[model samples]
Target chain A: MPSLIWFNEDSLNPEHQMVKDYADAPKVYVFDAPYLQAQNIAKHRIQFIYEALLEIPSIQIYKGETVAVLLQLIKDLAISEVVTTETPNHMIKGWQNELQKSIDLVTYPEIFPVTDHSSPRRFSRYWRKHERSWLTV
Target chain B: MMQQLRTDLELADREAIATYLQSEFPFVEDSGELSPHVGGRTAGLVRLQSFRLEKYGKQRNFLDGEVSQLSPYVSRGCLELEELRQWALKQSRSKSVEAFVSELAWRAFFHLVYEEEGDRILKDMEKPKVPMNQHQRSLPEDIAAGTTGIPSMDTLIHMLKETGYLHNHARMYLASYVVHFRKVSWRAGADWMYSLLIDGDFASNHLSWQWVASTFSTKPYIFNRENLERYAGSLLPGDPKQGDPFNYSYEELAERLFEGAYMPEPSGRSPGQYQ
Candidate 1:
């Protein structure tokens, strides 16, 4: 069964490392109507995403409820699995849970370096601890 | 089984994208073309390559600073902060790059705060170090109109409305003016700025406003005419045709804006510490 790679805003680049990892899979990006409506994201931002989408070749764009779109695509294409890059978003986590119920879903770890310490509320404290580890030449 | 709900959704060009967005989200007014700053991965790469890290550190605060106008791309995830950092380090290995790198770190820091604290970043991170003058939750119509009677701020507001961009120093000044001087809540000011900015990120924009409002800092950030002249004087041509509201010293500004709601630090802590 074929698999689909869903691209979130954080992982939009066609050259994203995760996209290379899923080279043979068909790619899809949903406008995520619920999230857009809930966030009331600015028009300029949507324009930016629209421009970015135009750059990617052979990718599908969907505009509707995220889980519903995924389910429809899965059934229509006989997709056995779904994959996407991991994000810190709680909403995405919720979507991932629903998507996992019907199909094999895999989320790659975030592309950036991870700190051993938990993220701190104060930037000064977080910087004091993590800068030495991450900011080296 | 796959129904083609919208294969026609492929936006052919910039014009098509604008039309689709306008029709789909009729509530949001069209802001016209974004600044010459291009979008997409290719453009992002070009921007990263063109940035001069050494100059950026020395001049980023000025109105015409040698800043890397990459925030829009970075915030949109067209370019990653780590990628930019690596590129900067590769180009030049010097402490000069620290300022530019720290700005990127601030972006990452804001994201971390948002991820961990979630919506709570929208509120005060800590109780105000100085008592706030309890103002309205909504932004004042005059400020939104860009007719605040302060020449520098009005000019900045006009530029923000016309071009979806503002200098970092200008942003802090405006944020300070709105939250502290005008006595508007930071949430109101943050919402207004986020809506207008092309580089708008919920984490960075709101959190920075909180920083200015003294909610996320040890003291509220305020600026007066002399500070503005040092950074933006060249850009702000002509005299204050209107009454110059911001033409005051630090003590006078603090006294007038805060109206006894603020107290001066005892002993060694000078008034300059507020800025």
Candidate 2:
């Protein structure tokens, strides 16, 4: 089975909250690296995740890192499919493009289900306010 | 950097406290002994909450000691805004009470923007549809010093410098003046505010500065001397009728109607992997 991982940072959305909110129950893993100093943990984790992606070639990663972090994470994870709620702020858009080179990225508009949304569209072309009937799908 | 930042950071914290006091308690003159409100201490909160029922709304507009000084605490999470929102909603279900709740929601919204956007909220990415001077202007020390020579703004400058607090109205005024009258970049003002406001969360200050600069909001924010005098009239002591009721000497009003002044800065460069 393909594994799904949630990178937890305890922002407005945390791992526990993500587990509850996300409709699909993917295999959840919390990346832990206590051996590294607190300051280096984030960077080390990215490096670790990247190395793991190269070896396993089966793990799928979902992320919420800062834009800069996401850039490196995408290359490291070798992610082929991304599913996330739309962000009005553009940093996440940057991550979507980086992953697009090799993987499939999908996003549900913030006003989900009601908003006509389609996966695989880049943020720039992701039009706002699609027809209601299409969104119901 | 710590030593260089020592005074500025201290000033920031002090200003945050000051801003909270000024906004919440415009009537109190003394900064007497008060216990910590957070870290398991409830003394300060209890004392602050004592005035919540009366002056929280009634004296909010009064510049002196009429409002609640809890904003900095709320902004920095020293005090939970959700608690305040719930308390206020319970106290009075009227529009006035709801207004306070809405203000708290705005803080949450600012945090949400940053939580979702991260550092990109600070970057300028959107290319203005209309071309103009692309140069960035440095922030003025006087403005930062709150010494722009505008009498009406003196309270704001004094609050920011001496205490670290600026009235909510004062914040709107100063931000508008800095972004419009002074024609300074919102980033500079925001940076200076962050450096000096203890309660300065990246989201709240940044978005608010942009809001007043008309960079984040669709409408241009402005304040005239008459408007200021009218709002703050009853707050000043003794001779409430004092000061210019119509006009005050400050930057002359202009009608340039600038564009591309309200959009958020763009996030980092987008990746090439489009669907």
Best by DockQ: 1
Q: For each candidate, what is chain B's TM-score?
A: 0.86, 0.66
Model 2: runs farther than 4 Å from truth?
Answer: A1-137, B1-44, B54-62, B124-136, B233-275
Q: Estimate, for each residue in B183-219, the C-alpha lDDT of model 2 and write its tens digit.
A: 6777777766654443545677777776655445444
**Residue-by-residue lDDT tens digits, candidate 1, B220-273:** 787767777777889985447456656776667677877666654533222221
Q: Total clashes, candidate 2?
A: 24
Proportion of the native interface contacts kept in model 1:
0.33
Instruction: Looking only at chain A, give the TM-score of model 2 against the true structure.
Output: 0.33
lDDT against the true structure, per candidate, is 0.73, 0.44
- The candidate 1 chain A region of ten consecutive residues with least summed lDDT is A109-118
**Error at B237, model 1, angstroms:** 4.6
lDDT of 1 at A137: 53
Give the clashing residue pairs of candidate 1, or none. A76-B1, A76-B2
Candidate 1 chain B, poorest ten consecutive residues by summed lDDT: B266-275
